[model samples]
Target: MNAMVQSTVPASRTRLPRKERELQILDIAHARFAEHGFGAVTMDEVAAAAGVTKPLLYAYFGNKERLYSACMERAGDAMLAAVGAAVAAATGPSEALRDGLKAFFAFVDGDRDAWRVLFDETLPAGGELARAVAEYRDRLLALVAQTQLELIPEHSRERAATEVEALSNALLGASEALARWWLRTGALPAAEAADLLVATVEPGLQARAALRDRTASPSTPDRDQGAP
Candidate 1:
């Protein structure tokens, strides 16, 4: 009777494929870190949440820091890919900025936790992890700078590079702030939030483009008086 009862019961755990298991662990870890921040969460908590042994978690991710890094890398890479693809598909500078912002907000809206993981302020003040995060930010900044530079004519790009980079930094900062606010308040839909940002910034961007265009174009020469 005892043997029969034991046979009837299911095992506590089932083996998963390696990639599947890794992804599962990452998803759980990502959520935990996002909710509690890296400093407060523990491997045991994540292991329990993931229904895995602590040894297995360590075997897979090596340590808590590594697990955190993995989460950051995944979130950051996904965000960059989404925004890059959106920008690549755009027909013009304005479209690129608008599409990129939409893609960014869409990503945050789809997974607010992932956005938190990517931009967690609780990360160590200075370390390899912080450096890694900075590298991701730099990559994003470069992408935005390139997008901003697109608004300037090719001939003016060299001279406008500094201003474009500054504008890119400001745009990224504003977007991050707005996203956090959106997450906190839920005041606007993702598309509308993106549109609001676009509306606020596009006029200035267009004005800069126009200014550069005028500056770069040679002034029209007056026709010779009384000459055919």
Candidate 2:
């Protein structure tokens, strides 16, 4: 009788535990969101893709907003955790930045599709989606800005904070664009891409710092005096 009952049960019908099922749904939803953007991807599609019922999806995620938030949260958590670990392991601010960059490039190189899913323009047409995207980017820039603050010399730290923050933001934008270009070219390795970024930006920041000091020096004539 036990053998007969076991034979009658289909393996596909077995219920997956809650955590496992949630992961499966997220995996499918991520792919759908990547392909169709959040606005176009319906809960029904994800449920069907994951072989789960609509009610089950709702039971786990409440609604599309929460579901999307959960997905973005996971990606953001993983990214920050990796970058944080790399930065924490470094002995100095420069090494911290280098480690963070290496981790970032390595992540994208290893999982381009995952990176695109997080950064792509397929977000649902809602304020929630906008907030989600902004949260990821803002946190990332915050990390870099913090690193910049750490790198400043003690005497200049107070006055340089604002400029460093602005510079960090610019660096983040430029690096994002450069990484996309590197992806297109696909010739340089991830480490090389990071090395190139550090080499280029470090000197640029130094030059800007030197210029600021020169312009602010006491010997410099006031521009209003026409001392050229």
Candidate 1 stretches with Cα past 4 Å from truth are 1-12, 220-228
Cα lDDT tens digits for candidate 2, 1-228 = 999999998788558899999998898887777667777889998998898899989999999988878877777778878888888899987798889888888888876766766776666555877788888889999888877776665556678888988988898887788788888898899899999999888776666656666766778898889987
Compute the lDDT of residue 172 as modeled in candidate 1.
96
Top lDDT hit: 1
Clashes of each: 0, 0
Over 1-228, each residue of candidate 1 has an lDDT whose tens digit, in order, gives: 999999999887878998899999999999899999999999999999999999999999999989999999999999999999999999999899999999999999987888989888888989878988889889889888888888888989999988988898899999999999999999999999999999999999989898889867777343565433
TM-score between candidate 2 and the true structure: 0.81
TM of each candidate vs. truth: 0.87, 0.81
Q: Which residue window of length 10 is worst by lDDT in model 2?
A: 149-158
